[model samples]
Structures are given as structure tokens and as C-alpha cells.
Target: MTTYYTEDHEWILVEGDQATIGISAYAAEQLGDVVFVEVPDVGTAFGQGEDMAVVESVKAASDVYAPVSGEVVEANQELEAAPETVNEDPEGKGWFVKFTLKDPAELTRLMDATAYKAFCDNQ
Candidate 1:
């Protein structure tokens, strides 16, 4: 599996044609204590960079964008009752959704782990 990241701080863990998506730990930390998350519904399709979900925190509410276009295959229903998981495990069980990638080529446009770390360091 390969992982990619958007400048907006969302990450996608790609496995075959499907990818699991989530906000990065940096984004979760910046957002502060997460209170709620609104994940996109299964079967929903979105263009790359589209607003796919909402994450609310004590600091503010933020839109979670699609790092790559695709049809939503599953959403983390566990978030509705345990949004704090985002703060605790932003890259793990806190994952927001899984989707079938619309264009696998799009993955090439995102940063890899090394590049993403450098990008964040500069920010």
C-alpha cells in the first residue's frame, strides 16, 4: 500500500483501487478537540478536492476535502459517537472514509510521506 497527502492535510492510504481517507495528525492537532464529524455517505461520488465531509472541533468547524475523486464505499460510523477518536488516532481508526478511486493517476499528484513531512516543516 502507498500513502499520499494533500496540501490541505488529508491523507489517503491506497490499497488496490480503494483508498482509506483521513485528516493527518497535524490537521487534527491544529483543529483542537474534535466534537463531531460528518462523513460522506456510502455510494456518494465526488470530484477531486470536493468538500466531502465536515469536522467540528472546539477551535472551529472545517471541511474535509476529497484528496482524490471517487465513490464513497464506506464511512466511519463510529465517529458520530466518538469524534474524539480523531484527536487520538487521526491516521488510524479515526479514518473518515474509504472510496474507490476515480482516477488512480490522481495519486501521483499528491505528496508522499517524505515530501509531506517537509511540506509541514515549512508551514
Candidate 2:
């Protein structure tokens, strides 16, 4: 599996033509205590960089952008009732959605883990 990061702080873990999507640990940290998560429904299509979901924290509600264009295949329904899972495990069980990738090339435009770490460092 390979992972890519968007400037907006979303992460996509690519495997074959599917990717699991979520915010990074750094983003979860910045968002504070999450209280709600709203994800796109399965079968919905979105463009790269589109607002695909919402994450609400005690700090504020924030948009979660799609790192690449794709059709939503699955959404993490568990988040609706237990959004704090995002704060506890942003990259693991806290993942927000899964989508069928629209363009594999788009992944190249995103940052790798090392670059994302550097990007976070600069922020």
C-alpha cells in the first residue's frame, strides 16, 4: 500500500484501484476533540480537491477534501456515532471513506509521507 497527502491535510492509502481516505494525525491534532463526522454516501462521485466530508470538533467544523477524484465505495459509518475515533486514530480505524480511484496519475501530484511530514513541519 502507498499513501499520499493533500495540501488540505487529507490522506489516501492506495491499494490497487481503491483507496482508504482519512485525515492525518497532525490534522486530527489541529482539529482538537472531534464530535461529529459526515461522509459522502456510497456511489457519490467527487472531483479531486472537492469537499467530500465534514469533521466537527469542539474547535470548529472543517471540510475534508478528496485527495483524488473518485466514486465513493464505502463510508465509515462508525464515525457518525463515535467521531472521537478520529481523534484517537486518525490514520487507522478513524478513516472516513473508501473510494474507487478515478485517476492513478493524480496520486503523483500529492505528497508522500516524508514530504507531508516536512510540509507539516513548515506549517
Candidate 3:
């Protein structure tokens, strides 16, 4: 499935009814190589726009937000072993978590590919 992005720069690709979430290439590039990822524990509930993880890079730390209100279902444990994957493949291998979306309406707040491009251009 193709991914959608939030103005905050989080990305989520829905598969079936669940979605896998991550930071975008724009975010990873700005952060540089990832050093650590603080993924939410499984079962933690989050509201849309809530900060869920702390992505630590060589330069600084940034919060990764929840694009849709949901319960965290899975975290990418691979990030603990090789956080650099976020820089290597921010959209693919770098996915951060998976969640069961609680409110599908939250998706309406996200940006589509074209709109995201405009948002990035303004930044």
C-alpha cells in the first residue's frame, strides 16, 4: 500500500485495516542518522497527533507523533539493534510501529502525496 503523510512528517501505510507508521524521508534527512528509537510499548493507546516515540539522532532528539488515534500493536525492535536503518530507508525498512487505528476519521487530517509535496515546499 502507498503511504500517507502528516504535516508533522509522520508517514503511515495501511495494510488491510491496520497501518504501519514511521517518520518521512524529510524527517530522517533533517535528523541525520538515527541513533535510537523509543517506540511505544505494545498496548499503549494514543490520540491522533500524540507524540508516541522519541527518535534520537546524532544531533538531537525528535518526537514521532501518532498519525491516527490507536493502540500500539507492534514496534520495530530492529531499530534498537540498527537505528541507522531509519536513514538508509526511512520509508521502507525504517518503519517505526504498527497500530490498530481507533478513529478512521483521523486519516482525514493527513496529507496525500501531492499535498505533502506542497507542505514540504513551503517548509
Candidate 4:
């Protein structure tokens, strides 16, 4: 699996044509104590950079955008009852959706881990 990151702080773990999407740990920290998450339903399709989910926290409600074009295959239901998982493990079990990539080429526009870290540091 390879991981890619968006400028908006979303992460996508790609494995073949499948991908798991989530907010970065940095974004979860910035949100401050996530209270709720609204993930797109299975079969929902999105273009690269479109808002695909919503996360609400003590500090604010934020939109989680698609890191690349795809169709939702799964939504993390665990978040409905325990959104704090985002704070505890934002890059792991806290993931929002699993989807099939619509265009693998789009990934080239994203950042690798090193680039993402530098991008965050400058923010």
C-alpha cells in the first residue's frame, strides 16, 4: 500500500485500485476532540477534492475532502458512536471511507509522507 496526502490534510492509503481515506493526525489535533463524523454512504461517488465527509469537534465543524476521485465502498460506522477515535487514531481506525479509485493518475498530484510533513510544518 502507498499513502498520499492532500493539501487539505486528508490522507489516502492506496492498494491496487482500493483506497482508504481519512484526516491526518495533524488535522484531528487541530479540530480538538472530535464529537461526530458524517461519512458518505456506499456507492456515493466523488471527484477529486470534493467534500466527502464532515467532522465536528469541540472547536469547529470541518469538511473532509476527497484526496482523489472515487466511489465509496465502505463508511466507518464506528465513528457514529465513538468519534473520539479520530483524536486517538486519526490515521488508522479513525478512517472515514474505503473507495475504488476513479483515476490512479490523480495520485501523482498528491504528496508523499515526507512532503506532507514539510507542508504541515510550514503551516
Clashing pairs in 2: none
Q: How many backbone collisions does model 2 have?
A: 0
Write candidate 3's Cα lDDT for 15-108 as tens digits.
Answer: 7569999999998998987899888899999998889999998788899989999988999999999999999999989999999988777787
- Give the TM-score (vs. native) of candidate 1: 0.98
> 21-87, model 2: which lDDT tens digit per residue?
9999999999999999999899999999999999998868899999999999999999998999999
Q: lDDT for every model?
A: 0.96, 0.95, 0.89, 0.96
Alpha carbon deviation, residue 83, candidate 1 (Å): 0.1
Q: What are the TM-scores, per candidate, against the unseen true structure?
A: 0.98, 0.98, 0.95, 0.98
- Tell me the alpha-carbon RMSD of every candidate: 0.6, 0.6, 1.1, 0.5
Q: How do the residues 31-101 of candidate 1 rate in per-residue lDDT, one tens digit apiece?
A: 99999999988999999999999999877889999999999999999999999999999999999999999
Q: What TM-score does candidate 4 reach?
A: 0.98
TM-score for predicted model 3 compared with the true structure: 0.95
Model 3 collision count: 0
Which has the higher TM-score value, candidate number 1 or candidate number 3? 1
How far residue 97's Cα lies from its native spot in candidate 1, in Å, is 0.4
After the best TM-score superposition of candidate 3, give how far the Cα of residue 93 lies from its true spot, in angstroms.
0.9
> Where is model 3 more than 4 Å wrong at Cα?
none
